[model samples]
Target: MMSLYLLNTKNTYTVAALMEIAKELGKEDWDFSQNPCDGNPNWVTPTGNLSQSKNVVICTCAHNDSCHVVNITLMRQDLTGVLPPSLAKLPSIKVINLAFNYLNGTIPNEWASTKLEFISLSGNRLSGSIPTFLSNITTLGYLSLENNLFSGKVPAELGQLKNLYLL
Candidate 1:
């Protein structure tokens, strides 16, 4: 016999993290209408819909019925303020593009542990040294820290990524 693991419950961490992200970005009305996977076909008790929400997208998990946030693209929204550290809670996130905005402050150190493959923070007003932890994300293939106020030398560890093609 084979063992199986399923996640029937909602991803509360991602929900809370999104709430914090909206609050931090000054878009308090972004969306909290319901759980991301509330009314999906896989759920035992489906209710509500995710399509009503704007500026948000989700990806369903394969081994489980639950959904996880995979991308957050708020490019050129004129958004201001710093990124909340809470965003790291979304373990499944892959792409985070907040480019062409007025956001400032340092990149949250908490993001160093994410499974991010693409990160585009270009055309912003962010200032500070790029966190060394970024080089630790082996999944990272594309990085765009250009057009910012980042100081210090690039981490040598980034060269270790075999999949990375863009910078």
Candidate 2:
């Protein structure tokens, strides 16, 4: 069996950033007693069930033996807050699935500086036109903005993402 000590603690900066993200998303369930890299219920749930109302934060410790959040899945949570700009503070985040929530507001401008790969914001009340800054996240591969109240034609700049397969 793996020892609990093998799990690395998230850097204080990362922890602070995650806490801000939770506050912005109205998520009060995050358990700070355990490190974000610990395989606990709040940190890592049983599955990626987007149909269920749950919050999951996942981190990776393989690189440099330090913990870094890699994925966050908070779906059907009925979260009544805006998309968090604090998400950009985690440099290792690759996938963020916040689908089926009651969240409003458009993606934050801070996200333009992220190295995200996949993002699913479907089934929300997000409004405002899709930002052209999305194209700035050159590493983005998949993006889902469906079922939102956003108006205006898709930005032409999004075509700049050569790795993007869906938008």
Clash pairs detected, candidate 2: none
Candidate 1 residue-wise lDDT at 165: 91
Question: In candidate 1, where is summed lDDT lowest over 10 consecutive residues?
Answer: 38-47
Summed backbone clashes in each candidate are 0, 0
lDDT of 1 at 65: 58
Error of 1 at 139 (Å): 0.5
Give TM per candidate.
0.77, 0.88
List the candidate 1 regions with Cα displacement exceeding 4 Å. 1-8, 34-56, 61-64
> Candidate 2 residues 53-115, lDDT tens each?
757787877757788888998887778899999999999999999999889988999999999
Top model number, TM-score: 2
